[model samples]
Target: MNKIVAIMAGSVWKVLVQPGDLVEEGRDVIILESMKMEIPITADFSGTVKEVKVNEGDFVNEEELLIEME
Candidate 1:
């Protein structure tokens, strides 16, 4: 199984992937905004995106699970 981890502490600005989307390692799956800057959440492994755990504009902490893969 693969997991996508949040890159920073921020509000989720957008979700770039949906369930069943094929994601490559180091791909940006979500965008977050913090301190007026945008950060991209990236996948650590290549796999099909199994789930998106957060919605647009949702607040997320550092290291949160943004997506699951398998």
Candidate 2:
């Protein structure tokens, strides 16, 4: 399994992947709102999404796990 984690502390603005979705390396998988700016978080590895750990509008700390891939 691979993890997609929040790059910074923020509220999750959008979730671009769900379980069973395909993802590519560097593809934006989540967008976070911090300091009123939209920060896109990208996939670190190309794989099928295994789980979505956070929901839209959920606040996350830096490095919190967002998605799992396999």
Candidate 3:
């Protein structure tokens, strides 16, 4: 089974992958900017990205689903 990991921080600056992209565990999927710092949201499991729930420069809240993998 696969899981979805959201951006834990509320700052979505860049989306690194698109739907149908193959992802590995610990790979950076999104880059977030908070307080002028960059943070990376990584994949929790090895799977293919099924969907991208957020886009580049989209403001997201904590625990907001950014990508779905399976």
Candidate 4:
């Protein structure tokens, strides 16, 4: 299984990919708002998204699972 996680604690500003979306390495999956700035979270491996584990405006802690893919 492949997964994407939050790199820092922040509110989700955007979810760029959805379940069943084909993702490439280095694609931004989530954009988090922390300290008034948007931080994009990227995928390190190519995969198909299997689950969306968070919603826009949801707060996530550092290392929190954001998406599941395989």
Candidate 5:
């Protein structure tokens, strides 16, 4: 399993991929808004998305798991 994690503490602005979606390394999987700036969270490994761990508007902390792929 591959885990995609948040880089900063912020509110989840958008989820770009869904379950069963094919993802490549470095592809943006989620967008986070913090201090009025948009931060894109990308996949660290290429795989098919297995689960989305958070929803839009949810607050997340640094190092939090955002997506799970396999």
Candidate 6:
């Protein structure tokens, strides 16, 4: 499994993919809000989305796992 982790502490602003969805490397999967700014999280590798570990509005710490892919 490949993990997509948060780059900074923030609240999940949006989830752009669901489990079973096909994704390409560098595709934006989640958007996070921090310091009143929006940050996008991208897939690290092309694969099927195995799981989304965080939900919208959920707060996450830097380096926290946000999504899994396989």
Q: Which candidate is the best by TM-score?
A: 4
Candidate 5 similarity to native, TM-score: 0.96
Please give each candidate's TM-score.
0.91, 0.97, 0.86, 0.98, 0.96, 0.97
Query: Which lDDT tens digits does candidate 2 get at residues 33-61?
Result: 99999999998789999999999999999
Worst lDDT 10-window in candidate 1: 1-10
Q: For candidate 6, what's the RMSD? A: 0.5
Name the candidate, 3 or 6, with the larger lDDT value: 6
lDDT of 4 by residue, 2-40 (tens): 778999999999999988899999999999999999999
CA lDDT of every candidate? 0.87, 0.93, 0.81, 0.95, 0.94, 0.95
Which residue pairs in candidate 6 collide? none
The residue ranges of model 5 lying beyond 4 angstroms of the native Cα positions read none
What are the C-alpha RMSDs, in order, of all predicted structures? 1.0, 0.6, 1.6, 0.5, 0.6, 0.5
Model 4, residue 29: displacement in angstroms? 0.6
- For 1-70, candidate 3 gives per-residue lDDT tens digits of 4655555565678889988899999899999888888989888889998888887877878887788788
C-alpha lDDT of candidate 5 relative to the true structure: 0.94
Pairs in steric clash, model 1: none
Q: Which parts of model 3 are misplaced by more than 4 Å? A: 1-3
Measure candidate 3: CA RMSD: 1.6
User: Clashing pairs in model 4?
Assistant: none
Worst 10 residues of 4 by lDDT: 1-10
